[model samples]
Target: MTTPDSAAADVAAKQRIIKHMNADHHDSIRRYVEAYASKSMFHSRSAQMVDIDLNQMVFSCGGQQAVIAFDPPMKAMREARERLVQLDKDALQTLGRSDIPITKFVPAYTHPAHLWNFTQCVLAMVLLPRQANWQPGSLLYDNMLYLVPGFASFVARIGWIVFVYQPQFQINVMGKPKLALQVPVEYTIVVFADGASDSLLHGSLSFSNVPTQCDFQIALARVGRLEKGKKMKPDSASRTLMGELGLIGSQKEQKREQFDYETAEKLCVCSVGPPQESSGSKTAKCEFSLHIPSYLPATAMLPSVNISYAIFATCILPDRKVLQTSQDLRIVRETVEPIRLEPSRTVYFPDTSFAVRANFDPPTFSSKNTTISTTLQLYGLSLPITNSMRFTETRWLVPREIRWVLEETAVIVTGCPDTTGHLPMSSAQRILKRRKLATGREKLKLRYPFTRRGNTPVSMHSDGSGFSVPLTVSGPKDLSLDASTALSVAGGHILHAILDESNSDLNELQWRFAVYLECGLHIWLRIGEDVFDEASGNLVNRKMDEMAYTIVCPLTTSRTVTGQHDRGDQDEPVPMIPPSYDQVWEQPPPEYATPEGFTAAEAHTTNSLVPQDLLG
Candidate 1:
């Protein structure tokens, strides 16, 4: 019953589907394998669709095969594509890769073991020992004379030789040894209440070797404008003592400035020691609470200046030897207060001009969209007397385009030279110098434009004296504006409108606009002026009319569930309608009747007449 033409058509359709899937939807296949196949203990590095039908899909990963079934069979290609997208999203959510984009999931090529490294294999075979007595067919020879051990030994020797002479490799393998005291967790200190409130520093310290006496102190240092190849000097008293003890030798005098070091707070006294222990190594728990000075600046690292704080713990041994350990802390300023602004201004252009006014409802916005309403009033329009005159009149001073933009600016350090010149002919020095330099001490600006929808055209009055146009604008859904900061950088939203007067036989006009800021702050803008250079394409002239507002949207505290749901048995029956109340309460209540008695009192005492054995 099978026809040759029908079979060939079916084969052609299948081949087309397979080719499309392999070319375009490779990422989806890889995601599917990572989500499902990985859970089944089949760790497939890559997957390709070998065969696909309306009801099922078969994938091959390095000759290993897997099949996935579609619950509702796809009837069209569009439906299949939609279903594939939905499945990919579900798999990403289940695998806790929701933040990762789909295009990043490329299939990894898995090479066969024999084809992994041909040169290494050849070298391994060359280094392998030859045995003439071993026969190829014997089980003993095949099991005992294997070349795996010899190849492994040769590779290990080569690796050791390559890494032994490299100092950077040795340092990476064996890091700088720490002191006897070890702190497992780093501490983050927050400066709040305008640096008036106190922050607590707490951690546990374990000692591998115990010392007789230990002194712990918390030091705060403010270092500024540190030049290259210059060392910071200690206090005058310490320098005098060192000089008196002949510790300072005759050396070249270098221009150096003393760093500001202060004992902000003392954690423990000199009498403090490690915790008492019976036999095992001892661990000490330390805690310090101190109020940070309001005059001190928050922690910041720049090219020329740095402000930092640390906790130092020093141990004095019996032989007058000292061991020390320290941990750095990070400090940040608190959130800013909310702000709101509302301004009204008017400007005059020429004989035919317009007055534009903008208003923001509520004035303050967060991550969500905010609505902006603008009104334009046109006046001094030359009226037409007759139909011929009206036909001769041309359109002039029309509002051409309106746009809303959100801009963000931040000041960061840039263009700093490398400070690793002290390393002498080390590989790390070369690597550090060869690394690309970061953009430092520069301003970061991000601009996002709002999309505009279609609106009605401008209409004129019956008298032709004046006309008004009212429009509404909103911020984009994907716009992320930062809160306003007075110290570092500022950000705000701006609304710009361009009017076309090309058809009119009038000279170009310039109008000044007012920008209102909080706390007696204001900015002025000049219209019909170019803010940037035409030939250089650089912002030579600054636009003072731009305004920045604070957006205070906090992140959601809810946690997303990334686990997969269990698909219940498909063969089980599912009712179209739920059971009714009457069906659920099918059992009726029993009717109660009083026992027949000669008198009411006897009826009440009927239970007493029963025998004791019957009651029991």
Candidate 2:
């Protein structure tokens, strides 16, 4: 029954779909082949979409072809994008992974605030290699480290290693989008009663972020150990190796290694090969990179989640002695999506003819009370001039008011997931939701919201134009709103100075950064939805309760990082307004205030403690 035209349309649509999937979402294509198509041939390395139809998609995975059909074939071409997202979600769940597009790891050492810390780290690196402790059974191993305060925390690992070299860290992209961590380390083996166990370098990772710190445990590069499925045991041998030599330092250090190996047996590892030892070094030296699997929920603090990664270099001796040292890992996520330079959106009412276009100045925001230059253009407002009577109609449509609302949705994760991937009792709280700009109805035809713009002489012109310039709305040849009519118009919004963009930290508590930021713009129009006039094909409007509801604008927000470089400036990080979502960030705090406890003098203190932001 299909016609030639319909067949051609289908062919074109399939080609476009295949090209997009191969270019942007190859990860999904790989997953599709592994999950639905060939399991052994592809090996999840790479996949390309060669062709697609309404019912199915054909992929070439690792030179192997796969045809994955839709459940009930797609009826239209536009449904392809949404269908792919759904399929990706299913693929991720099946692959036991999450959509964590972790591109790179960022270290805090580059920041000026960590200068003293970095200096000490450098000092430790210099002193470690020159000392006897870097040698096994030197007894004096880490003896000097104890004399200094935080030095032991860096170079010392518990187990069979005596002297250890402070490592230099770098990130190598194993394949595209994989952050392979490379660390160079040198260590002297501890000479036991029998002999030094075989030395192997491994790493474990943990991280934490806002509202609370999340205790997600992850182990990395556990190479050259017991068989892949076997777990590490904490025995007297691990203890004597800690106590007998200079290896034993703290009780906390002893339990961590055993716990990491036992609990994180199923942790994802992209590549696991024995460390390549260098023949040139005096000590057992190995320089290797670990291709850490993406989205491994770490422990410590990151922008998305406050989490840190650790390394556990273990050696199972002939006597089963284990050696190790761990440190806090600092990592930052790379910007995946580019920031919009000009966030211009148009709002159209299907029942009306006049369209309202909104333009927000790019990335003009503050920690609180951010002032922005905003403009709303009114278009398609007219009644046609008559052919015979030649009567030109002139009328005005005015905006009643404008306002701003800021919302914060905070999410908190609790216990580890069960076998079925169900959380025991994780929750989130809405910490802040308040209106930064409040507007009330005015007797004037046009009510323009006004606030200060940086160093500009005036934020608005007499005719309500921005930057103190004269502006005329394009309309009838001789029509113009006067200075008084335009003076009150505010094309921009102010994120009240007291308002804060969502922050990602609170020390000690086990919380993850799950707070999302959003803005709601309400434009109250003096004119309601338009009505059609049958005579001249013109649209007119009748008045209703204008203040009852508002036309909301979807706005895009970004953060500005100011740098004072000697020359120009460093490349600032892209501002990310975490995607708006309603998730539990924290368990709701217990209500402590009672009539007797609530007093006037303690008001300011109470305000500081409680999230008293008014509901928007």
Residue 249 miss distance in model 1 (angstroms):
25
* Total backbone clashes of candidate 2, pairs 3 or more residues apart or in separate chains: 59
- Model 1, range 33-145, lDDT digits (tens) per residue? 77766622122434677776678777765323567777788874446667777878988787776645534633223455545565554444433222322334434346764
Residue runs of model 1 more than 4 Å from their true location after superposition: 1-196, 226-272, 278-284, 302-306, 336-616
Error of 1 at 188 (Å): 7.8
Global fold similarity of model 1 (TM-score): 0.27
If scored against the real structure, what TM-score would every candidate get?
A: 0.27, 0.27
Supply candidate 1's per-residue lDDT for 11: 68
Residue-wise lDDT of candidate 2 within 1-616, one digit each (tens)?
A: 8889988887788777877777787778877887787443213455567777778887654323467999889988778889989998998888777789777966756787687787865555444554445444454543544465344444444311322322221011111111123343322233333223434345422111100111112234221111122346568778778666767746665546433432222233232322233112222223344444322321322122222344443332222233233433432222232233232334333333444444444333334434444554555444343443323322333333333332221122222223333333333232343323333333322222223233212233234322221111111221111111111112221110110112211111112122223344444443432233334434344444332112344444333332221111133222221112122222223333333433433321110111223112
Q: Which stretches of candidate 2 lie over 4 Å from their true place?
A: 1-261, 265-285, 293-310, 341-345, 348-355, 360-375, 378-401, 406-616
